[model samples]
Target: MRLNESTIVSASPKLIWDYIADPGNALHYMSGVTRWEVVSERRSGLGARYRMLIQVGSAEVGGLIEVVEFSPERDMAWSSVTGVDQRGRWRLRGVGGSRTRVEFRFAYGVAGAGITGYISELVAAPSLRRHLRRSLQLLKRQVEHERLRRDAAARQATPEATTA
Candidate 1:
């Protein structure tokens, strides 16, 4: 099954890309993801691999996934290397000042499970869509909050120039 969702975040594309492209920040925004750990020495960007598991029904499903495409602050795509057959991509575009349009796409299917896999996909489609939407919402909240925090810190760091 294929699922796509998008949201606008009040943060620059670079900020959104930096946060989403880094697997270390997945737990902060990815809903239903129970495990997201780097399995390869290379941490972020192209060729990076991670062992991930997402809650599905009463079980967790996933495997090692490798980054198949990386376009700096624009796009990041990955596919499963082992375990469940899946592909995912994140696309970010700057929309006006300090606004980013972020889209997440995911596709998954069983390789040899045949009918059972189809049935599972049918059953899990709704939940998966819901999770994807929730994840985006969480991501938007996180990025905006971080932006606010950073802006506040910058303001605090800059002392007012006293008039002579």
Candidate 2:
């Protein structure tokens, strides 16, 4: 099954990319994700691998996933290396200024369950969709909040020029 969701974030594409592309921040924004930790020595960017798990109904499903594609500040894609069969991608488009359109897509199915896998996919569709949407919403909040905090700090750091 495939699921797609998108949201506009009040932050630059680079900011959003930096936050989402980092495995350390996954648990902060990814809804239902119970485990998100780098399994490889290399972390963040292409070739990075992570062990992940997301709640599906009463159980958690996921596996070791590797960054298959990485375009700085633009896109990141991953595919399952073990466990459940899955592919996921994040696409970021800068909509001028500090606004970014963030899109997420995921496709997955059980490897050997055949008909049972199909049935499970069908049963999990609604919950998956809901999780994806909520994830994006949480991401938006996180990025925007961070942006505001950074802007405020920058303003406070600058001293007012005294009129001569």
Candidate 3:
């Protein structure tokens, strides 16, 4: 099965891309993902590999993926060669000033195990979809919150900006 979702983040595409593109920052946003860490020596850009655990039903299932494509501030795509039998990608685009459109897409198998896999996908996909939405929302909230905090600190340190 295939699933896709997107949201506009209230930040520059550069900032948002910095976060989403970093393999080490995986745990910061992904909802179903319990943990993710780089497995290879290379941590960023193409060819980076990571071992990830994603909660599926009552058990956590496979999520080890490798960076297949990486374009700074624009797009990144990864596919699991060993685990979970899936491929996923993150796409980013500038939506005017200070806003970025982010998209997440994945295709996973519903083959084998017959009705069991079908039923699991039926029940799990909805919850997984919600997790994706919330993940994006949380990313937006984190980036915006950090921006606000920085602005507040800057204004406090230099009151001239506010008064000017």
**Residue 40, model 2: Cα distance from true site in angstroms:** 0.5
What is the per-residue lDDT of model 1 for residues 66-158, given as tens digits with 9 covering 90 to 100?
999999989999999999899999999998988999999999998889899999999998999999999999999999999999988877777
Q: Which sequence of candidate numbers ranks them by TM-score, best first?
A: 2, 1, 3
- Global lDDT of each model? 0.92, 0.92, 0.81
Q: Candidate 1 at 89: error in angstroms?
A: 0.6
lDDT tens per residue, model 3, 127-152: 77887788888888987777788779
Model 2 pairs in collision: none
Off by over 4 Å in 2: 161-164
**Model 2 deviation from native, Cα RMSD in Å:** 2.0
The segments of candidate 1 whose C-alpha lies over 4 angstroms from its true place after superposition are 161-164
lDDT of 1: 0.92
Alpha-carbon lDDT of model 3: 0.81
lDDT of 2 by residue, 96-148 (tens): 88799999999999878989889999999999999899999999999999999
Task: Report each candidate's C-alpha RMSD, comma-separated, in the order given.
Answer: 2.1, 2.0, 2.0
What TM-score does model 2 achieve against the real structure?
A: 0.94
